[model samples]
Target chain A: GESVGLHLPTLSVQEGDNSIINCAYSNSASDYFIWYKQESGKGPQFIIDIRSNMDKRQGQRVTVLLNKTVKHLSLQIAATQPGDSAVYFCAEKDAGNMLTFGGGTRLMVKP
Target chain B: DAGITQSPRYKITETGRQVTLMCHQTWSHSYMFWYRQDLGHGLRLIYYSAAADITDKGEVPDGYVVSRSKTENFPLTLESATRSQTSVYFCASAVKETQYFGPGTRLLVL
Candidate 1:
């Protein structure tokens, strides 16, 4: 069975530093990928998304990098803040709009 | 404007009891999905509907049923609840590009 998985289950980073979270997907047929930030007690919020046709996409303070060759995806956050702490998940949309999500990574920011 | 909403933001029911979670969207999106979120399992799809009266099972669909008689409403029902069924359930709608998620309903079975 194809699955999307993350390399780190939890990450602790200091404020003002950059944080990088990695994810690996098993399905090559997946054409679209998205990154979501889930706050405590809330649903996942869309951060940014990148298509397989592109290698990278950047948003306000976040960036998503897709390495299709290695079947890898990564999310980068700049100048991490306390409010930036939350569980992050990566989702892949195949032929259908049904999204398969990866086990989230808990991002903890240290003051 | 109510983009997407779920009824009974929080629910507590007993085992063997039946509970239903309601989802409503105003976007008239063509795709709607139900997902469960738990520790270690980020978000597993339980069921999804491509259009009215068109439904299909997802990764985890056992012990659950869904009906989409209208494009704006997609409700998930638990025939007989169990402890293993306790988790936060989310309802989402996709407008062809990206999926928009509702707040979610937290269910607890004792």
Candidate 2:
């Protein structure tokens, strides 16, 4: 079965430093990819997304990079903060509009 | 305005009992999705509806049933609940690229 996976289950970063979370997907047919941040006791929130055609897309303080050649995806957060700590998940949507999600990476910010 | 709301934020039921999770959205989005989140499995889609009266099975839909009689409502029903069905279920709606998620319903089957 095709699945999306992350390299690390948990990542700890300094509050002022930058953070990067990596994900790998198996299905090449997936054309759209999105990054979501899920806070405790809340639902997942959309952060940013990147299409298969583009390599990267930037948001306010977050950026999503998609490497189609390796079926890799990454989320970069600049100037990480305590509130930014949460479970991050990468999702891929094929042409059918069906989305497959990764296991999720827990981001912990150290003060 | 409430973007999306799920009823019975938490539920507990015994095996063989039936349970239904309600999802409602006010955005009038064309697409609605139901996903279950477990420890090992992050989020697996159970079902989705592209529009009213148009629903399709997703990755994990064997023990679940869904119906979208109206565009604003998409409910998931477990005819005979099992212990394995215990998990956090989230309802989401997508306009085009971005998806908005509801708070989620926590179900515990014993």
lDDT digits (tens) for residues A1-111 of candidate 2: 478999999999999999999999999999999999999989999899888999999999898888989999999999999999999999998876777889999999999
TM-score of each: 0.96, 0.96
**Candidate achieving the largest DockQ:** 2
Cα lDDT tens digits, model 1, A1-111, are: 478999999999999999999999999999999999999999888899999999999998899999999999999999999999999989898986778889989999999
Which window of 10 residues has the lowest lDDT sum in candidate 1 chain B? B36-45
Question: The CA-based lDDT of model 1 is what?
Answer: 0.94
- Chain B TM-score, candidates in order: 0.99, 0.98
Kindly report which residue pairs in candidate 2 clash with one another: none
| Model 2 chain B worst lDDT window (10 residues) | B37-46
lDDT string for model 2 (B2-105, tens) is 99999889999999998999999999999999999998878888999999999998888998999999999999999999999999999999989678999999
lDDT of 1 at A42: 91
Every model's DockQ = 0.73, 0.79
